[model samples]
Target: MNKGKGRELRAMLRDWRAAAGVYASLQWRCFHQDGRFDPFLDPATQYRKDGAKVRAGIIRQIVLKHELDVPVPEPVKEGEKPKKRVLPTPPGLSDCLAPMKAALGAAQVQMVQGQVIGTLKSFISNRQNDFVDIVLGSTIDDLGRRQLFTINRATAWFDLGRSVKVETVEIPLSARLLARKIMSHILARHKKPSMKRIGMVVDKRVAELEESRSATSHDLWLKVTVKSGDHRSRRIAIPMRSNDYFSSRQGERKKTFQIIEDRETGRITVGVVTDVGSSFEERRMAYASRAQGPKALDFGLVTMFASDDGDLMGREFLRKLKSIDTTISGIARHVQRSGGKPRDSKRYVAHVTRLRGFITTELRRILNRFVAVRKPTTIFLERLNFQSPELSRRMNRILQNCGRGVLRAKLQALNEEFGVESHEVVSAYTSQTCSCCGYVDRRNRKAQAVFACRWCGRSLHADVNAARNIGSERFRSIGSARRVVRSNVLDMLVTQHVQRNTGERGAPADPRMSNPHFAAWADKARLSTKAA
Candidate 1:
C-alpha cells in the first residue's frame, strides 16, 4: 500500500476503535440502569420485547443531549466550503441534537445492548458471585465466504481478515416532549454514565473458522478496513507467535469464542472454546490405571503444598513470595508517608503486578508437578485460608485475596485434565490433632514445622501430619460434623479416639482422657447431650 493509503487505513482503524468505545459506554449505562424487564428472566424473551432498542435509544438521547450536542461537519460540495450541519428538532421535542459522530450501525448498537442484558442475566443467575469488566470489540458474524471476519491460510502466514462497513444513520426522534422529559428526569436520578470500550462475545460459527485452518504457523497478518464505504477492507501483515501449545491441545473447536482487547497495551486476543473431553478421559484412565490411593494436600505459606506422602512442593515459595511482599510493603509505606495512593505510584503498581504474576506462575507449576508425580486417584484439600506472620498484615491480605482464587482455579483445571477428584476437608484442628493416635490437643504442634503427639509419642512435620489426618477415613467421617463451637469438634475427636483404642461403640473412660483438656471436653459433651 502507498503512504496515503496506509495513513488512511490507520485513521479508519482509529475511527472503528472510537465507535466501539462509544457502543461500550452505551452498554455500560444500560446494564447499570433499571430496565423495563427483569434481568433474571429469559434473555431471548427480553430481546423480543425491544428491550435492547429502548435502552439504546435512552442512552443515545442522554449522550447526544449532554456530550455530543456540537454541530457536525457536513460533506463539502463541488467548489464550495463544507457547512456545519445540525439535526432538525422533531415535533414536540425541545433539543435538535444529532447522534454520535463515531456511532456504530443500528445492528451493532442492538448487539451491544443485547450483550449488556445477557451479562445482567448471567450475573443475576449466578447469584452475583463473579463480576466481570466490560471488554471492547465489535461482534462479528461468520457468513462462510461472506463473513465479516475470516481466517485464511497462506504460504507462510495465516491471514486474520475483517470486512467492516462504517455507516451512520439519522435516528428518528419520535417520543413526545413529556416522555422525553420523564426519561431525562429518570436518568438524572441515577449515577452519571461512565465510558467503556466495546467487547465481543461470539456465538456459533467460530468452529468453522478454526476448522478452516488446516495447518498452523507462527505468523499472522491482520486485514482491517481503511475506508468507510460498503465492506471496505485492507490487509496488514504482522508477525506473532502461534501459541502452538494451546493450539495443539484444542481437541474439538466449539462454536463460541471471544475477541478481547486490552486498551492499555493495545493487544488483541482471540479465544476459541474447544471440547477436550474424549482426550482428557483417555489420559484420565491412563493415570487412574497406575494411580495410587488418595492423597491429602495441606497448603501453606512457607511450603506451597505438603502432601500426606511427605512430599513438600515449592519449599522456597514463601521465601520468594515474602521477598516480593517486603518490597511491596516498603513501597506502600513510602507512598503512605508521602500521602499518596500506592496505586498512583508506578513502582508500587509494577511490584503488585509482579507479585500477582509470581503467585500465578508458582501455583501453576507446583500443582502441575504434584498431579504428575503423585498420580493420586483423589486429592483432599482444606478450604484455603493462607496466613503468615512472616509478612505484613497488608501483604497477607493480598496473598489471601489473590492466592486463594488462583489455587482453586488451578486445582479445578487439574481435575478437568487428569480426572482427579478433589474434596475439601474441615481444616479445624487438623494441625493440632495427631494423625497417628487421633489425639486432639493444641500442644501437639510444638512448633510451626513440628508435630509431636502428646498421647502416642508420634512425631513428624506438622503440615505432613495434618495432610495425613485430612486424608484419613476418621477425618472424612467427621467431615460433616457441625462446627458450632470449638469444643464440639474437640469432643468428637476425643470420642473417636476412645472408640478406636478401646474397640467399643460407647465413649468409655480411657487413660488418655485423664488429661485435663480431654476431661473438660468430655464434660462439655455430656452437658450438651443432656441439653439435647
Candidate 2:
C-alpha cells in the first residue's frame, strides 16, 4: 500500500476503536443495570443452551435502546407463506449511532458486542467476591509483542564502571569507642545476637559520621544522551547511586524503552524491553526427549521437598525461615505499639523483602537441585499448604501467598527450560496412606515424620510415603479425586486393599484377615489380635 492509503487506513482504525469503546460502554452500563445479567455470571450457565433466548432478548433490548442497525427478516407477499417480521431502527435514536455505524463494519460491531458481554460477565462474577469496577477506554491494541515501535537504526553501549563512585570518610576515636560500646551492650543483652541487628547499629553510626562530611560529599550524576532523526543529541544528567548499572551489558537495544519513577522515593529509572528468544520450545522439547520417568514430590514446611526416591531437600529451610519471621514479627510488633503502619516502617519493609527474597531463592535452588538429581520427565506435586503450628499466623499467611506462587512460577520456568512437566494431584490422605499395601488409615501416620502403617506394617518417612503414593498408578487412576469426599476415597482404598490381598471379586473381607503378611508381621511385633 502507498503511504497515503496506509495512513488513511490507520486513522480509520483509530476512529473505529474509539467508536467501539463508546458502544461497549453503553452496553456495559445497560447490562450492569439489567437483572438478567446476574444469572449468566454463574459458571454453569455458559454450558446451558437455555440461556440463549434470554441472552438474545437482552441483546435485542440493547439494540433497540442504542438504535443499532441490525439485520432484519424480509416480509413475504400476501399469497405466499407467513414470513418473519422485521424491526426498523427506532426514529428516536436514528442519528445517535450514525457515527458508530459509519466507522465500524458489521463484523467489527459484533466483535465489540462480544467483547463487552464477556467483560461484563467477568466483572459481575468477580465483583461478587472482590472490589471490581468498570474501566472504560482501556481496550487492547492489536500490535505484536515487542513490535509496537519501529527501530530504524540505533547504537547502544553499557557504562558499568563509570556509574560507580567510591569515597572514604575518617571516623573519630570517640565515635569508634561509642560504636564498640553499643555492640558490646547488644551482645550482652541477647544470648545469641543477630549480626543483622549489630550491622544496623554500625550503619547508623557510619551514616551519622558521613553526614558530618556533607560538604565534601558531593552529588554523583550520570549523563544519558538521546538523538532523534537529524536533531542534535540531547544530554541529560540523572543522579546516580553507587551500584546503579545498565542491565543490558552486551550493548543490545530493543524497539522500546520506558522511564519509570518511584512514587514514594521519587527515584527515576530507565527500563529496556526485550523479546523472549524463540528457542525456548526447542530447548523444552530437547529436554523432554532426553528425560525419563516421573517423580513425585511432597511439599513440607520443615524439609521443603520430599521425593518418592527417599530424598529430602532444603532440610534447614524451616530454620532459616523461622529466623527471618522472628525479625519480621519483632519489627511488626514495634510498629503496632507505636500505632504506625507496618508498611510505613522502613525496617519492616526491609525484613519483609528479605523474607520474600530468601523464599524465592530457596525454592529455586531446591527445584533446580531436584531436576538435576532426579532427571524426571514429569513431576507430580500436590497443592501446597505451608501452614505450620510452629510459625506465627502472619508468617504462615506470607508463606501461603509468596511461597506457593513462587514455587509454581519456578516449576513453569523449569518446564520451559528443561521440558519437565508438573502436575498437581489430590493430596487428601497421601500422608496417611501406606505406599506398600495401599492401606489408608489415620493411625498409619505415627508422627509428623514417621509413617507406620497399621494394616500393612510398612514403616517409612511420612513425606516420602506420601510422595510415593502420589506417583503411584493407583492414585493417578482415580480421576477427579479432588471432587470426591475423603471418606469415599478411604472406602475406595480399603476396597482396593481387600481386592489386592484376598483376590476377591465380591465383598471386601476384614482388612486384617485379608493380608497374611500383616498377620505374620503383627505377631513378630507382639501386637494383640484385638488391636489388629
Q: Top TM-score: which candidate number? A: 1
Give Cα-based local distance difference scores for all models. Answer: 0.59, 0.56
lDDT of 1: 0.59
Per-model TM-score on C-alpha atoms: 0.60, 0.52
Q: What lDDT is reached at residue 43 by model 1? A: 29
Backbone clash numbers for all candidates listed: 6, 0
In candidate 2, what residue range of length 10 has the lowest lDDT sum? 148-157
**What is candidate 1's CA lDDT for residue 482?**
27
List, residue by residue over 1-532, the lDDT tens digit for candidate 1. 3455445444543444454454444444444343222333332343444544454455555554466664422223589753233333334131111132323333333444456556544433322111100000112222321121111111000111222221332112221222233334434554433324544544542112322233356344333223344544433432234477755874786655455554434355556678989888888888888898788999888887899999988889889877888898899999999999888888887777778788899989987888788888888888787778888898888788888789878878778888888887777889898898788888888898998987778999999998998899867765542222355567788778767754312444443445665675556556776788
In candidate 2, what are the lDDT values of residues 1-532, reduced to their tens digit? Answer: 2354334333433444464455555554444243223322322233243345444545655655566688322323478753223334322222334454445443344444444455555544433222111111113132311111110000000111111111233333333333234333433453421111110001111111111223333333333332222433333333333223343222333534333333334234444434434556666666677676899999998888999999998889989988988988998999999999888988787778778888999999888888877789999888788789999999998888888889879988787677788887778789878899888767678888999986657899998999999899877766543344555566677668656765322343345543443454335334453455
Per-prediction CA RMSD (Å): 16.9, 24.0
